[model samples]
Target chain A: MDIIASKLFFTGIDIGSTMSKAAVVDAEGVMLGYVIGPTGAEHRRRANMVMEDVLAKCGVSLDEIAYIISTGYGRVNVPFADKQVTELTCHARGVAALFPDVRTAIDIGGQDAKVLKIKNGKLVDFLTNDKCAAGTGRFLEVAAETLGLELNEMGRISLQSDTPVKINSLCTIFAQQEIIASLSEGKPLPDILAGVYIAIATRVVKLARQLKVEPPVVFTGGVAKNGGMVKAIEAVLGMPVSVPPEPLITGCLGAAILARDEAFKLINRGEYKLQKKQLSEAYIEFTEKTR
Target chain B: MSGYYLGIDIGSVGSKAVVIDGSRIISSAVIPSGTNYATTSAAVKAEVLKLAGLKEGDITASAATGIGGRNAGAGSYHSVILCDARGVNLTFPAARSIIDIGGQGSQLTSINETGQVIDFSVSEICATGSARLLQVVARILQIGIEEIGPLSMKAVRPSNFSTSCTVFLETEVITRISQGDKPADILAGIHRSIAEKISGMARGVALNPEVAVIGGGALDIGLILAIEEKLGMKALVPENPRIIAALGAALIARG
Candidate 1:
């Protein structure tokens, strides 16, 4: 966190559409520390803040981290990253590290949803709903707000319903209307909440089905923390789905692991050089077009 | 059975009712659709009947349309698209194309000379290009929906939005506000994006001349102007645009 921050460490920064996260790993890809927070309006500044927060939490100094890799939609905005890897690739590596046999991985993040096909631990091919909010965290957030309930409360509450209502709208806003209509129709709150998750699961599972989902499927991303999503997705997929212990940190951990691999690979070739990154809030000039 | 005919459109955002005696529309009512569609339907129906100086017993037949059409307590419900074509033709005899942009979505219907449907298309649920976003923006900006049109008209250079998704556009507007952009400029940008999306959807159908724009979205002058600019032509609007589908329902009831 400070100038004298020393020791050999690698880091991964994932500045996603909604949340910005950072993870630090030792030479063996063991996570030393990580930080997660809302991306807020200013991502460039948030990127530097997340990196410093993770390092501070780990008691590591700025100079101790040997390499840093950035991923996710806002990856390009991380000035301190030694390299930028696509989130899908990072996800594949991260999930493989967690579940070695995972052949399919689906991540429903804040704005976009993706289904990644993996071979062993590397990404094969993928499909994404990046341009829309049909089956993503945004859908759940909208539903939560409409129901006048906390976002975290929905998952557990949805488990109580035996009959989830049918939701037809795929658009997040239109789906909110459907939720309202369901509320008006005297549908139980649990049923409506369960239906919301089912709607998202239906869309994402449909995407997964398009790829002929191989078993050992793992789900990650912040949305994976929701129990309702896990249940709905499993039901829709007609197969069990596994979630990592800390699903939200997988992308950043993957980046950290990738950084470690990259650092070691470079050291073996006598090409290991730490990127000179000053983690400071000095550059506030370019907030525009950062996203 | 020959007293008067009534048509009610219980839409997602609003419920509208039209009362007609013979071929002439006597009165109409528009009200916000609250949590209960049936409740709002009754209110709208009562208001229209009262405005027309008629009682429930005087109504010969009634029909309903829109998303909550079935709950309107009418004789029967008709498809909104069919009602739209019928209503728009009645409002504007020369109109061969109808662009109905509601609160939550948009629809484009092309009709024949005799008011028979030729072809029609509905915008994707996410691609509504409707007033729903405007209402949200208005709330975020702490202004009335009525103020958006005049407020957006003052922008010298409208902010150029990069995304079409309403959620992303909303974030963009917030970002712009934080960056010290004027509300007018941001509103102009929002209108531009909405117009671009609506016009794009309209183009997917067999667009014909004398295009009539209706529904809650037509009430936004800024959106209407921007849509006209995007389509490169003037769009005709009725005096009361929200009840086009209701009028169509009324005509169907009359028959």
Candidate 2:
């Protein structure tokens, strides 16, 4: 029992623009518990809260966490993070763990969207829409607010429309005005919602198509939970996409996997004095070679 | 016998109707263009006629311009660029360039000495720099759109807004708000961003001296200043910028 207690346990924290997530995994890379919460103005505090929540859920203490890896927009701000990795790399690794055959990954988050091309569980190329939030979860949120619908309810309502209304404006503000005009024209709510989904899908598809995105694609991030978006993306891509059970935590999960791998390497090297540090050369080499 | 000519410009954001008796403007009305374009056009026409103390049948000719102009039930329709150029020329005779930023889109037209449009360019597919974006930002900031121009003038250090995409601008604005940025600074940043985008579009046109800024978006004094700072030249704005297009349409009706 004492030996088991002393065994290495890896933790990963992802502090995103809208939410922070933490995942715990054992030496075997099996997830023990995960926690997610809104990331308010204070990112460091939110990261700590998520970490503590996940550690408590897994019945593990802070000291028991052999290594802590952080990822996402606020990755560098994690006080206890042992290593900081980019969300793009984390998402690729996380999706590869769940779907070994995934050749492409599309992650639509609160304020950005990314499309990754993977080959044999490694990231080969990627594209990101960091300049704008046109096709991201924020766009959907604005549309939902305009229609007086809950974020989670958008997918279901959108699926009910037989013919989606055309949203001509690419700008969100203009799109809102268009939606208002459509409503006043007696267009059904479902049709307007469908139009919003299609608009997002169209923009995302254009981003994905920039790379050689092949089938066996995986969708990750909070937006992956939107069924209407999933359907719209699938229809645009003309192929089915695999979504992980916990899509929102994939970045954290990837960080956990990286932490577990690092812990094993340290043990093999007979370096018991574990100290919080930046990413190791081996990990950098691994990511570089994959690219 | 002298006759009255009516011009209606039904824009995406608002509608305007102007009545001109031969030489000078008599009455004009501006109202929010709701869902139904035909209804708003009819309403503005009636209001303008009432203000002029004349009947609709008293008008000799009528012309319409703008996005909904074709559906305005007018006798003739003119291109928005042409009307804008004529309207600006009427006020500022030496005006050689015009930047008309409307609700749904924007246009930059280069005119000759006679106010004939020589070259023109328009925003392709985005409305990020138009009046609609300002209205949306005002809603998000919980202030009236009319206040943004004045409030922005007080900004000592305007923040930087990188993206011209309205969708991304919203996130940036929210982030800035959360970061405790002053509303005046944010509004200044927005005006700067809009000016930058408009400048980018204006580069394709042969912009000369005596640039006249018109349309509903010209009401933002901060934006006008930003434009002047961006283009490195002063601009001429009329008393009621929103009525310029309608006035131009009325002039074309007289012809």
Candidate 3:
């Protein structure tokens, strides 16, 4: 009926290989709430959980949300999503929105890594290494587990190393062995961690170098939170890189922004009823499956 | 009387020693290489000597091979490629190609009719499909490495593991386990993955029959079957697959 008078919100969920993140935004492009957690076995169930969690945090009701966009590896499995967008586009948009001058966006996720070349606030070219997890968060997780350190502590601890050990293995499995061998040799923990960060940074930089990478690079994804990795990357690139405030939510935020834009366009065209009906049907199907 | 010959293979993961009098293996021992290669080499040699009930001085000549071959205190050293070729040929004279999957690496070698290595490809850069990868998977499954082969053989539906990187495979295994996939299926998937990797390495070498699979990984019956399936032909495996390299080393020492 009077759809124009009602306040509309959008939700975006990114069900990554290791973690799932959700973001809620109002029609005006302001982020209201966000939530992130480990992506468990069932991707569909995890997506729904994250959606509910973010909505609850924002004190928003499911009915008030106008659109929901899903991205990442499990994007297609999001039962209640109105649209499924590719993570590459979402990441580029998210980083561009944060840093308008960013020419390159480096996203290192749990299972893969991507390098995007942005020109004039749009993605021009991109390269990805989905074939392996050598430079991704999974590598760091394994390294941290092998070193008996928390994943979050790797960056800080690595900064304390005076003489960083050289990690020659490009494979994550062999890297774990190398790290273990270093530990048994009584090498300093900080040095070993430094080596791990440098190895990952070297891999990411190699991916970035394949493209025409210019300065003003933006780092996104879960791994970007590691200061040691950022420093290592900067050292290799010979340029400073900027990181978003909440690097983990960049993809989800971009998806939410897209959802908000698409919903406003529909509302403006007076086609709100069709969008609402589709979401309700999808939501019903998701509930039935969960039950 | 024929003289005794000693063969020591000080690999990255394990050290193997074989003592042979003439063509018959008198005694053999395998122990973890541990942190100290020299110490493990000495320990393995002593254990082999004890098993044979003979003193070190009784050995006429000794040869070593593997990652720690030079540092293992052997009288002579032979390349792993040469050792693998000679060792497999001794057991299966028709074997023209050998696939070796060790703890830290893997290799596929094609040999001439004379048991000399003609061409070889190694998996040193990535530990995937190596014995160490299986050991890591076993640790994650909380089962012994020996259990993987038997369990995998009973797989009703083996899962497909697309990633060849060992690090990614570990995560894949964890994800599969969490999804309530059967351990047998997971183990079978790992064997198949290893099989595909070894096959890829073998494709570079001109593999001619009889192809023999050796090294610590050959102990896994599931892997042997997978390799056979991948290559579209049967593969020969010696009775004591792990001791082939040591035996080859001993043969080299005899000369």
Q: Can you give the TM-score per candidate against the true fold? A: 0.77, 0.76, 0.76
Clashing pairs in 1: A5-A61, A5-A62
CA lDDT of each prediction against the hidden true structure: 0.85, 0.85, 0.84
Q: Residue by residue across A141-244, what tens digits does model 1's lDDT show?
A: 88887778898889999999889999997578888888877876878999999999999999999999899999999999888999998999999999999999
For A23-48, candidate 3 gives per-residue lDDT tens digits of 98876778898999998767778888
lDDT (Cα) of model 1 = 0.85
Per-residue accuracy of model 3 over B1-255 as CA lDDT, tens digit each: 389999999876678999988887899999977655667788999999999999999999999998777767899988888889888878888989899988878889999878889999997676777887788789878898788899899999998886777766776786787667898999988888888888888867988878899999998998899899999888898887888899899888987
Model 2 residue B61 lDDT score: 94
Q: How many angstroms is residue A262 displaced in model 1 relative to the true structure, after the best TM-score fit?
A: 3.2
Residue B70's lDDT in candidate 1: 83
Clashes of each: 2, 0, 0
- Model 2 Cα RMSD, Å? 6.3
- Sort by TM-score, best first: 1, 3, 2
Model 1, A197: alpha-carbon shift in Å? 2.9
**Which residue pairs come into collision in candidate 2?**
none
CAPRI category for model 1: acceptable
TM-score of chain B of each: 0.95, 0.96, 0.95
With candidate 3 superimposed using the best TM-score fit, by how many Å does residue B14's alpha carbon deviate from the native? 4.7
